[model samples]
Target: MKAILLHGVTAFLLSFSALGQMQSFSLQEVKVTGGAFKNAQDVDLRYILSLNPDKLLAPYLIDAGLPLKAERYGNWESSGLDGHIGGHYLSALAMMYASTGNAELKKRLDYMIDQLAQCQAKNGNGYVGGIPQGKVFWERIYKGDIDGSSFGLNNTWVPLYNIHKLFAGLRDSYEFGGNQQAKQVLIGLGDWFAELIRPLSDDQIQQILRTEHGGMNEAFADLYILTKNQKYLETAQRISHRAILNPLVQKQDKLTGLHANTQIPKVIGFEKIAMLTENAKWSEAARYFWQNVSQTRTVAFGGNSVREHFNPTNDFSSMLKSNQGPETCNSFNMLRLSKALFLDKNDPSYLDFYERTLYNHILSSQHPQKGGFVYFTPIRPNHYRVYSQPETSMWCCVGSGLENHTKYSELIYSHSANDLFVNLFIPSTLHWKEKSIQLTQATEFPYKNQSEFVLKLAKSQAFTLNIRYPKWADDVEVMVNGKLYPTSAQPSNYIGIRRKWKTGDKLSVRFTTSTHLEYLPDGSNWAAFVHGPIVLAAKTSTADLVGLFADDSRMGHETKGKLYPIDKAYMLIGDTDTYISKVKSVGNLKFSLDSLTLQPFYEVHDARYQMYFQTFTQNEFDAQKAKQRQQETEALAMEARTVDKVSCGEQQPEVDHSYKGEKSDAGYDDDGRFWRNTRSYMSYQLQNKGFAGKTLEISFSGNLKTEEVGFFLNDRAAEIIAVKDRVISVKTDNTELITLKIVSENGRPTPRFHQIRLMK
Candidate 1:
């Protein structure tokens, strides 16, 4: 009987051990030593910590002032500050402080907490904000009349959104930074939130949530984790925006027109809830949304959309037509979501997207000289980038810009206790706490397709090391201890090698390149030019075009208003037989443009360019290549004529240009010519000249601010005010003689007008 009992006990013990292994939930202790986040000095900790308390808390404290003071967003009677910004600031502060221990940051955080406690006391409820208009906005939302057409109550959600940022910040501070007081503050805020919502039914709550609110669910889930309170979890579940949540959970693409970043935080909350509750469907739903977006919708730069709205799938032909595409903040949130998914699945594909965006978009978003962020990375053929000012431009990009440069260390290394994953090839060092091992990765990467890893040991430890081979690399080679090893995983997957790694072990990897062509969803035959992972663009000479007007300085010149075909602009000088050869080979992965000899698209600045082109087959190319040559010959001939004849001409040179007028009362001359008076502002009139037998070119010259040139013809309005170095050209049917008119928004006449001409 004793022997039988012993056997059963041993079996039970074995089963328990297996269950423990399966249920492990702790995040592996992955420490980063190098990369973007490495400290330059001992005071770096203090500087990082200062991000929250000294920087973030200082603003709120100053707003609050002495006694029960909080800084006013604007006027409580008029301008109401939203909670989203505040929430992010607080969250960032808390997280930064937690990541780096700084006493100053802690002190500022503590003081702000005390001040908030006082404000809560004074309000006689859980309410605490600088804005008193929040109460009125909440009442209006409760009454179901939020259209944002009015001024006062329409601004309600702003404050709540800001508070959400604060709540999230506090939570991160507690969880990641080890600030217990942060947890206390978060719990109080959660309790207050519960009290505010308990009186309203689900229907009423849903009505109140219809406005443009940020991720309230994310904050509630965070609170749940801090307190382990079931009520907080319930709140998070209830606050899930059903419009977004229902479609996402149902595996539908109702996300076409939805705000990009606004919806991401809610899904993040869903991911957290799925983890906490062990709900398989919820986890699947979250993962599905991420996969669909990160894979199908993203552009080569790891961004999507042409106008902040998701265009129809596969119809990227219209991608370069708008200025509002791919908000920087959207990239920020998408990357955050990617990180979360990476932790959950341990997949290498997520890292691929992360690396692409980090290099092409996020890294380039910041100006290298000024450290200011670009508002938009314009893909429009001739549009220039607008950058944010250091002090004045507090746009959405600014908020994201603050956090983007600080978190590069987060993805450098990740592990699963027994295996270390080297994800990104950024120069960095990793200290694996569990194995007591330090691994240093040094590489120029993407630029120089080689990376080396050096192992350091306090004591020799045995572990598996997994290195990711990017999807762009084709001929990848890996070596260990001077012995070559074969790898089976394709690019964009991990090459895992388990071994008893000793001190002084070195691993070397070499990645080769290949040329790839990506097709747009629309059957427009448009293709993106890519070499390996890098997207290339044809660089053109920088033109000082104004925002909307054309320059009259080159009036009557033959070069003005000439539409040079793209083939002529970007001369294809390299061997067309092999597309890889067409990519001008520079040493390493870097290549120069064959047209203007400029750097890659990501490096090009202050230049008009094209990244996508319409490719033709060999037979078609042979037929069109001659025409392309002829067009180039004509352009060069025209350029020589202008220089020889117009350079010394006395009369204002007559340059032929065309402009289409809008349907409004802006009139044009019989030849479709319009004039702007230099003294009294006069709007140009338009008259449609019937297209007789052939296409006619309408040309005009005016000296006005680029912002002042507005041309309207055929129900279309074209502002040529900011015509940089390139002349305006458009092709239309001969039946419509498009009228051309230039008008200034400020009603100011142009400084000079040379002549207007129309020709067939």
Candidate 2:
């Protein structure tokens, strides 16, 4: 049994709650013995073992002034987000250890804790981090020399966010791996952080929170639970971002323009803080956030956002058009939030979204045959996805992907007192050692509609077995030993079977599901075919899958292949009511829709596929086709004219351009675009390879005044030829590469820049 040693007092689990409503079983208690989830977990283990611990530990050692054991891994690890992956690796190892009891995972987890402890010891101030110039950076923050922006603090990339990964990893190491040293290191680090920020006012902390800080509040809350320390709890409360929380508490939808994953972790932290403090407002805020994202912002596959930013709830056109669709990290954090809500509220409805995301987004993220993590799961009709190579890719998704599949059994079965709640239908064996009851769930799940549960008890005991009837299922039939058992359970409710179990008892459930077309949340013509919780998509093509396996380049996770014209994509033309009826069963979990063959989205990989399709009535098909063609022609022509474009405030585009600035900040505009403005200067290096760039076009969120801003190409003043409709066009001489700089003239703040394009 894995247990956290809380000041020498044994806490049975990290999530142990005294005010239990519905509680999840520990990863150790439920073992996924068989099924697709088990396979995914096994594949994840292989990837986990393939990683070198020494390389991951290099960042810590370098920060601690220790001898080098190995060089740090490249990509994000060596980039500004240094040691972020290392932190996530620790978490993955701990959870995988607890879930699989894998000896190798435990070995790696122990090694990480030992190395981190050494680093913490060397600092002598409970401070250890891999942010470049680590000592200098913390010292500056300690002295209140803070320069905060959306993704940068003091001109460094997300230092708070980077460090929070370590905080989370350390917490998970103690909670899941039961590593005693981790608890001490975590407490020490918590103290160091508390004291470091002690001098700063709440306003300064809130300013720092503008950057993408992970669940720091949650980490402090976890520490408070572990040690019963008032300081940690106080720090957690103090650091909670009020700007985001206040709107949520008031039931306002202010999330559309925010960074999706960044806000998700914050909400998770909010939920944790609410749980610890029993703050009803905070709890409601968390629930409100979930409801908005899951109902309004989320897509058919339980993923949200477009290009890592939450698109406007009323307009999802960007989601269907962008190659950078919903990010994997968003759903990963969403699941964490959902689980917290489900456990707290005892609402089985939370499991509906959980199950959908688990089956579609999370399951489809990893390549089955060739184990690689995915960063973006594009919803564009024919655009493919890019998978992350273990050595080269260290995107945020890779970090979350490392932890995604390892603990599939975490929520299969939850309990309240003596009553057992089977929330998910995954095949797993649950050992309730406290009650001496062993229950095994066996099923093919979506492939087959039936699941069988067998129980083995040491002695006869009367208890309630509550099996969730998922929201997707129309109706469920329960049978005991091949005889019908009466059930009046409705969808999204649980059917409880109260009985006195013997040594051997059997309960079987059969469910009925129907194929349906789920339209985009914005009520657009685009829709995805969903059968129960499984989304069905067609493998459109395998050609032009460039960078299918990612390279070490900063933007390598993007699919740079040809984006097939949206107008030419396969569309459903006919009666809307007949779409579902036209889907003929070709095989199990596979269907034939006209000439296209549809299968479970989780089964589609290594190819360009279509999840969402535009539907049209037969009479209006020609007119819509003509309209789409006109739009596509203009879009494609503009794409062909562009040499390179930089999304000014976005993370990847700025990072890829070697973005540098002073007195610069970023924000999302009302029209659903990100913009960056600077009082001093901001510059990005754009490639003019082939010396084909003839014009520079800069777009702003507001009207641009030429007199207010100065444009320079490679430090030389550029001649502005045209300024019209928030766009400035400047003549550009042919140069192989140039640094484009935007300066605020006479100390006036520059107009918010939305995009910079180098046109040929």
Candidate 3:
């Protein structure tokens, strides 16, 4: 009863011993030779080849006293966060090499490892990093002289976060790239770092953990797994922040106002330590975090957070209104965490969210034909996104985006001591080398809703094969050798067939998919149509796609195009049932709904599409329309007056607007608006193009107490003033441009400033 009532029905699908003992198949054992995954792998390989290796290696070479062969990248590469891309490139090459067996990628992987080894040897103390003056920075932290914040440590731009990339690269190099040399380099680097931090107390380590460290705990836990040493294990446990992990272990939702990506990687570390150390409390913490995020916080697109930070779950207005919506890196990390939880517990719920997110968010992120990756997927009614190029855009999404497509076969199938489980409908083949069993699966799935599996065995074998009955399927029909295998099985569980199987035996499973409307988690009036596991979206228009194809500009990741008035958005013309019933299936994976054309989200690239539709009750349609029209008029007028704007706590915007500050900190508010305030001063240059604006609006959250403020325009200071309004308007007489600055002279911190915009 505990198993059935707590987890899903598949909880008892396997024996207790088998559940704990099962492990993932090696990349070599299972190969994906066909399906849409193979096509994506092709595109990813081409994109990998397009990136210049010499450019990525420039930082390492420069720091190692070696000459640079190629120029470093522009945006993030030349910025303070240098050498991060080199690490992602290494991991991408390693995974691509393992998955595809590409000889060129393997060569590149070996070359990168060799260069890193050279850099490590030159460092003279087993320390290797591409952060400029990183040795000096670590020296300061080693002596207990640390000044840390959300994004900086000891006056450096996320040095720990930057180094975590190298750690991940080394781990992936040995795991997937199959390079023995990388193992030594990785272990040496770990030992070097451990010694540096060995003198620091636990309190100091926790203080350092306040900043974004990019799964350093996860990297340490992985190292423990690799070496079976307790020292690294202790280090991992010591660095795991109690403030974040303790509340989670108690099953609390304290995620609001926190950095989304930073905490996700920490939870990944927690789960890894739990698995390696057999600590159930840590495992529960990870599981609880997953449930809270996947169930209550997630959106219709299977993603959460707005502007790269978690918003209060009770309100999703900002999730729908903000142009900087759910981030691809957050989903990327969530999938990693979901995979870990699923392998640990074998719960159908994890697979449920995994399938939805994979189909809707991950698959839709990449432009099918253009081969560019998306940073943000805005859910705003008539908004769009920007894509990353190989040479120009080196944002965080570009790093994770490179790894997204090459490994689509990650969670397709799993096996135990003598049983196999089919988790996904992706077409692939599994070769169980232990039992000499070869099972191949083929299907167009979600399009055809049926899959056929053929087993090739040299001799008769006896084992149990569990086929997952997805929750989305209405009824599952299974056939053994063209004869109906009669059973009284339902969905949300696995159906196991235990019998003697011979060579060339065949089995077929067909699913009956029924259309249904899924409402937002917060019970908002927004709805999305889900047919089986595929999320259907309607194509809107192809207008004002600013930065649709990104350039080398720092802000290229943002979609700064003109926004359509929300009042003019196409509304559902009927009630909920009528809208669902009227979605007529057209040829191919498309449908016709009134004036809209619906299709699979992953297939609808190069156009603006709507996944969540505005739904109203049959009696309240006219009333809702009237209310929306008035609200949209105010929205349009407010939006039209903005000339230039800057959103704090976001990457591309801050960088593009020449953000410079001292003693500054950033976080998101409960309303999902991001804010950055400083004890010293912070500034962002706004382009007063043609001098059209008459006033400057500096936005801040209400009820926040602040000291007297001094504003600077182009290095000129104004009289100190205290403002209580949410938005403070300052008259400007600038003819061309002005750099806005906020500061406090009393040594007190400035108020939480939301955004700065020029208004007419």
Best by TM-score: 2
Give per-model TM-scores. 0.69, 0.96, 0.94
lDDT of 2: 0.88
Off by over 4 Å in 2: 1-20, 701-703, 719-721, 731-737
Candidate 1 per-residue lDDT over residues 1-760, each given as its tens digit: 0111221111011111121111112212333344333432122333334333333333344333433233323211112343333445444444445434446656655666666555555555555554445555555555555433001124232444456667766676566556676676677768877877777778666655544445688788877776688999999888776767777778988665444665676678788788888877777788888877777667666776543445556555445544344667667878877887777666667787887787767766665544455545655444455554433343446556655654566787777656677777777667666567888888776667888999988886666577777887877787786667765566666666666678898989888876666655555445566666667666654564332121222221111222334454333322345544555666654555444342345665545566566566667667788896786587545443331111000111111122212211121233223232323222222222454312212233544455565444444664332233323333333443444444445555443332332223
lDDT of each: 0.54, 0.88, 0.81
- Candidate 2 on 1-760: residue-level lDDT in tens? 2333322222221122332488788899999988788899999999999999999889889989998889999998888888999899989999999999989899889988999899999989999888888999989988888888778888888888899999999989988999999999988999999999999988888988988898898989899999998989999999899999999999999887788898998899899989989999999999999999999999999899888888998899888888999999999999999999998888888999999999999999998878899988889998899998889999989999999998899899999987788889989999998999999999999899999999999998888677788999988887765667655566776776666767778889999998999999898889999999999999999999999999998788888897789998988888988888899997798999988999999999989999998998988898887888999999888888888889988876787787889899888877778899999999998888798889989988665677888899889999898888878898986787779999998786788999999999
Q: Identify the runs in model 1 with alpha carbons over 4 angstroms from their true place.
A: 1-84, 94-124, 130-132, 139-160, 521-523, 537-541, 545-580, 598-602, 605-609, 616-760
- Backbone clash pairs for candidate 3 read none
Candidate 3 per-residue lDDT, tens place, 1-760, comes to 1122221112234433444344677676677777566777778788889998889888888777888889888888877778998898888999888788889999999998998898899887888888987777888899998766666676567788888999999999999889999999999999998999999999899989877888999999989989988899998898898889999998988898777888999999999999988999999999999888888888867878887778787777777877788899899999999999888886756788888898888888887766888888988776777878898988888888899887787778888787777888888888888889998999988789899999999798777777888889888887777867644555666777767788888889998887778887887787788888888887798988877989986667878787776667766766566877888888666888888887887787777767777776757777777787788788777888987788876644665677777778787665667788888888887777789877777888644443377787777764323343687776665657778888876667777888887777
Worst 10 residues of 3 by lDDT: 1-10
lDDT top scorer: 2
- Alpha-carbon deviation at 32 in model 2, angstroms: 0.8
For candidate 1, give the lDDT of residue 670.
Answer: 31
Badly placed stretches (over 4 Å) of model 3 are 1-20, 649-660, 663-674, 687-694, 701-707, 719-726, 731-738
Local error of candidate 3 at 739, Å?
A: 3.7
